[model samples]
Target: MSAQAVDGLSRRGLLKFSVGATAFLATAGVTASLSGCSSSDTAPGFDALRTSDLPFLLAVIPVMLDGALTGIPSQSATERTLHGLDSGLSHLSPEMLKLTRQLFDVLGMAITRGPLTGIWSPWENAEPGQIRHFLGRWENSSLELLRQGHSSLLQLVLMAWYSQPQSWAGCGYPGPPKI
Candidate 1:
């Protein structure tokens, strides 16, 4: 467990591995987009999220929103939350939008998703527990990139859900002061 070697990997070897992984991720992202695996077409009725992103988004929304959808029908609530997310994303700067889409591509592409999130099944077929486990794992991951991805997903979902008027009462947030 010395600084020079941990788990039998030398510092230089670790550095090389990190660089290689970064290159792989960059290449995979470009390939995913150019190869059409990350569809450019928008999801049905969505302004920002792509068709390839819908399955992952649909699966994650309910799990992340959890108890917040109480009184509303799940389908209706999910659609509204998704629309909120879409609207929010539509306003992002081009760079931010590209990064967000890349995050979705990572989740949508099977090659990246399985290794990163450990969910090999198509997102449409993924169970809530499986999604929860992935989220928890990413949130607690030692990798800073995974942690940032977790934060981005959490922020998007939470902001989308809480922005809806119907959700305000659930969180005890009174509407903005009359001023």
Candidate 2:
């Protein structure tokens, strides 16, 4: 059976876009990995997140969680959230995991990160406004890949924090009837 085509884009166009996106991701991951920059070493006590991921997450969580983190000691809450993210991400299907690692790889390395995200400084040195600009750029980008990447990162961070018991009180959720 022939595949049904979308109204505006021809199958060849769709195929070209898919191949380009895949090639871009592969290039990003391979470049980052070969640069000896995207360390596979996990963050302290983290099973999934690499050391390279820490600074990015640390800088992002504050802005992403804004009011949700009020009253919590920033450092402790961030650590807990990262730990939860590691735990949660460890259970993702292998394909999802690879996609996530690719996203992290792209964001972790200087070459791809600067061009793609418009944040020239390293994640550790990125200011709130810079991070905001990057996130906004990706979230509202015309590229589907960028938007999907933004959504994936946002969902992971939010789920990680909200899954933790410490965050329950912030959302008015009791401890599951003491079970």
Tell me, by TM-score, which candidate is best. 1
lDDT of 1 by residue, 113-148 (tens): 898899999999999999999999989975667789
What TM-score would each prediction reach against the true structure?
0.88, 0.83
Report lDDT (CA) for all predictions.
0.86, 0.83
lDDT of 1 at 71: 80
Q: What is the C-alpha RMSD of each candidate to the true structure, in Å?
A: 2.3, 4.9
**Candidate 2 lDDT tens digits, 1-179:** 34454534576787788678768867889778777778767777778888888777888888888789757887788888888899988899978877788788888777788978899988889888899999999999766888898999999999999998888888888868764
- Model 2 pairs in collision: none
Name model 2 segments beyond 4 Å from true.
1-22
lDDT of 2 at 144: 81
